[model samples]
Target chain A: MAATSFQRILVALDGSDCSFRALDFACHIAKQYPGCTLVLVHVIDQRALETARMVHLQPMVEEIVRTLHAAGESLLAEAEAVPKRHQVSATTHLEQGIIAQRLLACAKEQGCDLIVIGSHGRTGLQRVLLGSVAHAVAQLAPEMVLIVREGAAASAGA
Target chain B: MLERILVPIDGSPPAAKATTLAIEVATRFKAEVRLVFVVDDSIHVLAEPSYVQPDYTFFADKMREEGEQVLAAAAKRFKDAGVKVTTQLRNGYVPAEIGASVKEFKTTLILMGTHGRTGWDRLVLGSVAQGVLATTDVPILLVRP
Candidate 1:
């Protein structure tokens, strides 16, 4: 039996509350494993941009995509700071594609042993329309996947 | 703050891998490990002919015995590793039982394996790991072998 040593971990961050919680959890694990490296990723959904382009002017769509990429870079920079706060350094990646596919590709390309993600815990129509990217990544990723939820029991009570 | 780690194991290779992973995590966190085997009788019901059937109790008893064996083998590994371990054999829907076990044990984390099923099989059978994730608030660490 292979032991769980998570030497390289990939964390998907989208600047959402839940994703930040996952980042915190990843940092904790990295702290626990002295040699562990955390890779923070932000994927810009190209499909969304394409849909925007179909409805809006080309220049407007290009501008929106550019702004989104800039936001992704800043998001990665902010997430990289998280691990540093815990005294653990992290690498960042900004990619454009389907969110789940990009995250899984990054994990495989980086040889990540584990992929950590935050669950939005969406239910009903929102879940069906948006779908759960974390769930998709969990289903497809070859590495171990950790799904983190924020607030714990306290939020459940609310 | 992970006081207990809950692991749901079937007699599959992936589950065995998950057990090993759970042990590694438990050792690192200094947490007790709780291994649960859920004997899902609903599958038997679905497979059986509606007209004629054998004693459900008898079949359930046999499944419980088999679950015990699987649990024993898994528990032995943890014991040999000198990790604090506990085991449970639950007879119910696999996902629901696991969710209840998490609450009853106050499990800080759930560690289990994902059966890498794709296409029709995954859609029709669904996944226990996904079900548990949907139903429970507990954090899950899924190992894919």
Candidate 2:
């Protein structure tokens, strides 16, 4: 059986509250494994870049990339606190690609044993227009995946 | 109300591990397991010679026979564990057929092994569990082997 006891863990983050909720779950898992490696991955969706490219706007593209870089860095910084608080070690990576594909590719390339991802809690109209990234990654990743729905983890404590 | 579960088996170790985990969870829930196998008609046709034109009926019969043996072995595992066991054989897309059967048999849940066998194999064909998840609303418990 593929190890439920994770040695290498990957958490996909988007700087959303839901993503932070997933990070919390990842931290809990890392605490359990103790020796496990945690990787925080942020994928800058290619669609955002394509929008900038369509308008032939270099300035927009630069601004978007810069904003995304800072967001990725801050997300990782926030995630770093989780592992440190738990006395665990983790590394972070920020990449540009299609969100789901990049997440799956990084997991495979990095030899990650498991993935923890947060569902965007999208429903109704938002779901129909923008498909869930978590859903797509779970479909695409070959490794074990733990899906934490928005508020599900917090509500569980309640 | 199916507190017990049924997982179809094909003798592949990936499927076997899935069956094992299903049995564990079903046992935990105090449920029984029913094993099912579906013979994909395409597999038999692809194996046939176009020049000689092997009889399709006879080929399907052979596939059913093979499926029975696979399910029988799977049934034995659960039966040995003192879990009520049943066997079924069907024909269609594996995931859709499994979903239909889950409803038909009133299965409470479906459990599947995600990776087929090895990492290399999964990186190639994607995953059956992934396909099932996309197709079905039924809650799935995926096991990785």
Best by TM-score: 1
Candidate 1 per-residue lDDT, tens place, B24-102, comes to 7777778899999998867577446673465455677787898899999999999988899999999888889999999
Candidate 2: give the clashing pairs: B4-B31
Write down the TM-score for model 1.
0.88
* B56: Cα error in model 2, Å: 24
DockQ of each: 0.48, 0.09
Number of the top-ranking candidate, with lDDT as the measure: 1
Tell me each candidate's RMSD, in Å, in order: 3.3, 7.3
Q: Check candidate 1 and list the clashing pairs.
A: none
Range of the 10 consecutive residues with the lowest summed lDDT in candidate 2 chain B: B117-126
